[model samples]
Target: MDMDNFREMFLTEAAEHLQLMVDLLVQLDSDPQDQDGIDALFRGAHSIKGMAASMEYPETARLAHHLEDHLADCRQLGQISGVEIDWLLEAVDLLELLLGDIRNGRPERNVDSFIAGISKQPEAAVDCVAETKTVELTACGRGQLIQLQLQESVAIPGPRFLVLLKKLADLGTILESTPSTEDLLQGDAPNQLLVRL
Candidate 1:
């Protein structure tokens, strides 16, 4: 396949496999010793490996294969933990980096050093995209947003929130409040206080 066609194909497959792995990892986080979760992760890693290799990206394939191996070992040992999850996340990150290299016209890289550094760190804090976006103020969801920056120590945020809440209660019917009107009045929220009508 030509470079453009090959890249598109690889990206689609990689995204699918990555999503599968991410879902499995989230499940594993909830239940560390889930057999199915482990299997799912292994399958995802394996698929990524095959796809990468076929796309002529040896570095990507190798890294995925290594991750698959580690997961296989975990299966044999019958345990997986936070640290292992961290290691896997690091491996995934390395694979992403290699993929980026390939996409950018640079040669794909062997990220063994990046993989090795995971062990030294001990805990891998994976960066996950936010699950739900803060909804925009829709037609029915009309309410004033009270945002307060702590840079200026004007007054207690609670009092400020209460003043805002009172102002909001006057505008229209207060359909739903996130932290409850009472709680907000008690100075519970911070930085941003949103009221959705």
Candidate 2:
């Protein structure tokens, strides 16, 4: 592998993802319940992880993976407070710094502090029993829920899923989505995504 070539491509892509992560973090800070924002944030971290690993940057990959895990936990618990958002933003900053070092031919920085900081935080217990819910719709709103299952073989489902969401939104107002737009954006959709419009 021509690492020089890969590094250039990685820098470009990683920079974009890092910027998106920061923007999503700011949005999440404003609305901690923003499932879409959380999903987008998670995707950014995930992309970084994948790219870093492919480029043989284990330290970068490890940190990105840890960040992705934290975001996943936040999504499951639905309890991302302002403090957590700030911590996430700081983590992003550290990632950006690490990427900068890589770009400048410096050695990978140690991310142990970041790992320790997040690990020290208390884990929120998820209410698995509360997952079930019922919704009552008016007579006029019947037939509004649409469930979509993406092809399992789709190379990258996130962008494709966004296209589907936009098409659905064009038809009518989206009342709800099962995996949520955020999850789709983050490429976390397992197989099916339900949309209510």
Candidate 3:
């Protein structure tokens, strides 16, 4: 395969695996005792690491490998706390950002801080508190809802969608999004994506 073709393939598959990892992490956050979720999360991280290494994205691969090892340790211990889940989610966000950089032809950014933060092992007891806090929306406090139509011929739309999602999240709390983050990460490539602030 052409190098361009290889890069495209890697981006497409990496996006799917990253999304799967995020979804599994979210599930694990809610139910830390779910062994299936833990196993799936480990596999997803491991897959991403392998793919990144094959693509010669050493930084991305190293980050993924660190996460894979962390998850494997969690699986062996049979517990993960809410704070740890938050850290993992943050790591996923960083991974998505790094992938976006590669897609945009930008140099890979250093992930040392993030890697160092999550590298530490957590205590044996798991905290079951929710990482995401529920907010009550008032009638007059509703934020704007925006709909975006991406070009149908766009290459690797999944990571692009995630970049947009992260940008939106930075501005304000996202109430909801269509084709949802989970759907987008799971390889859903609908032309239209709706977001509520």
Candidate 2: count of backbone clashes, pairs at least 3 residues apart or interchain:
0
Backbone clashes in model 2, listed as residue pairs = none
lDDT of 1 by residue, 1-197 (tens): 67799788887778777756755664575578899889889888999999988888888888888788888988887778865764565466566667668778899876777667644745423222112224556665465443323212222234334444554566777666656767854547464456664
| Residue-level lDDT for 80 in candidate 2 | 80
Q: Residues 108-128, candidate 3, lDDT per residue (tens digit)?
A: 889887677665644421111
The prediction achieving the highest TM-score against the true structure is 3
Taking all chains together, each candidate's TM-score versus the true structure is 0.58, 0.60, 0.63
Candidate 2 achieves a global lDDT of: 0.71
The predictions' CA RMSDs to the true structure, in order, are 13.6, 14.0, 9.0
For residue 58, give model 3's deviation from the true position in Å.
0.7
Q: What is the C-alpha lDDT of each candidate?
A: 0.64, 0.71, 0.73
Q: In model 3, which runs have C-alpha deviations exceeding 4 angstroms?
A: 120-197
Per-residue lDDT of 59 in model 1: 81
Looking at candidate 2, the ten consecutive residues that score lowest on lDDT are 124-133
- Candidate 2 residue lDDT tens string, 1-197: 68798899999999899878765765565578988888888898999999999988888999999999999999898768755764665577678778878999999989987798786653421111122223446675754666565433332334434545665677788888877878765656355566776
**How far out, in Å, is residue 102 in model 3?**
0.9
